[model samples]
Target: MGDVGPYPWLRAVLAAFAEEVRGLGPVLDVGCGPGEVTAHLAGLGVDVSGVDLSPKMVEHARRLHPRLRFAVASATDLDLEPGSLGGILGWWSLFNLPREVLPEVLASFACALVPGGHALIGTHVGAGDVPRTEAYGGVPVTWTTHLWQPGELGELIVAAGLELTAQLQLPASGQLRPQVLISARRAPEIAPGR
Candidate 1:
């Protein structure tokens, strides 16, 4: 996935998210495939790094974006420190996570984020799971693509203690399914004796 670049709408969403958390703290790109989006955020002046479950992917990302940081890690096992990240991105990356596990991951995101930090998630829009035996030029793989409706995903995000701030729904085109981009923000901290 060498700099395949993002869709126009995705670029806009990323730009906006980067602007929101530019100086708060570093951002983490969960499931960062090739670090393209990680590099994109860095170009926008947001401090960002990426992690992927596949060591091969992380290797490619590191080789491609040498200036950026990439690590081998799974979304399910991210041991993030509370109030550390300014933002977290799950851009088109969390579909493989089981439905039950996603909420826990979102909760982790909420806990890791600083007050006022944001989380941006992009996922295929639908209702069930699509099993796959191959992907990306027919590379042999075993995984399930779990599709979710906007409202269902939004409910999980809100339940994770983040406020839903924006949602963008895009229609299916070519081989791509309909997709939704949702952005949520952790509530800001309150002052003492306000």
Candidate 2:
């Protein structure tokens, strides 16, 4: 996935997201492994930075895209300023989080975004967790892949106070499970005496 750029559909989604958030505030790419997507948004002229749980991945991202900001941080422990971000991206990143932890994370995304800010998330589509012992190129790893049905994830997003704006579902192909991309936005704040 790192060798190839984002798929056509994903590129389109990301382009629209970048356009929506331009000049609103900085965008954070959570779980930004290797920083490819972060760089893509930057190329599209977005004010974007990236964070990942792995220090090694952060190092790689820094080396690969020196102009962009990359940090070692967990999605569960992000120190986001309230209403500071214009957008957030969880592209194929949050599925490893425990089911119970996801809602809290989503709520934080809601709290961290300025009114009218948007979050775009993509995840594998399925039911329960699939524990993995190896990853790409047979690299040994220990993590659980937690999957969600589209409706279930959408409900969680809405429950976190963001309004669902769009959903794209992709069917399973070859070794890959089906996946879903969802976009949600914080409602614009209302003025007093409206």
Candidate 3:
């Protein structure tokens, strides 16, 4: 993704954050619009693969990031086998998911992650379900369902078997709203004590 104002800075910050972190292995860049982030990770010597909902985006990403693997796939029903990923990076993707389908998609992410794997997702924070019909790059775009509360998002991820670790509240700017940067990890196992 190209820098839309401060988005470039945010991207840089996210890159630095990932690099300094340890323990994560191969990563799944979900909703990899143009594979820029995937390519960035590959440049850092991280094993990275990407998946996007748009075929055009997939083709563009493949062209831009020839060293990384990318596919046109839905987040709700990824074709990956169980325990296949070490981490997942979902950039502003959860907002695009319909409320009813969120749980199913979260499960897909969880199933693909290996034990102890983590996922970082960027999403809008609202007080109630927000119905926003907006335009992206001059294209008419409409997001079906968006969560308004942090608790709702927490419940969604926890239900998918991921434990919440952190949440970053991005600043709201212009017509664009801020989002919650959520990071969560998959538990290794259910403790016998529990």
Runs of candidate 2 exceeding 4 Å displacement: 1-6, 192-194
Q: Report clash pairs, candidate 2.
A: none
- Name the candidate, 2 or 3, with the larger TM-score value: 2
**Residue-wise C-alpha lDDT for candidate 1, range 97-149, written one tens digit per residue:** 99999999999999999999999999999989999999988999999999999
Compared with the true structure, the alpha-carbon lDDT of candidate 1 equals 0.93
Task: Tell me the lDDT of model 3 at 107.
Answer: 83
Across 76-146, the per-residue lDDT of candidate 3 in tens digits comes to: 77777788877888877667687788888888888888887878777777765665566565676666647
How good is model 2 by TM-score?
0.96
Instruction: Supply every candidate's count of residue pairs whose N, Cα or C atoms clash at under 3 angstroms.
Output: 0, 0, 1
Q: Residue 67's C-alpha lDDT in candidate 3? A: 69
Compose the digit string of candidate 2's lDDT tens values, residues 50-106. Answer: 999999999999999999999999999997899999999999999999999999999
Q: What is the Cα-based lDDT of residue 188 in candidate 3?
A: 78
**What TM-score number comes out for model 3?**
0.82
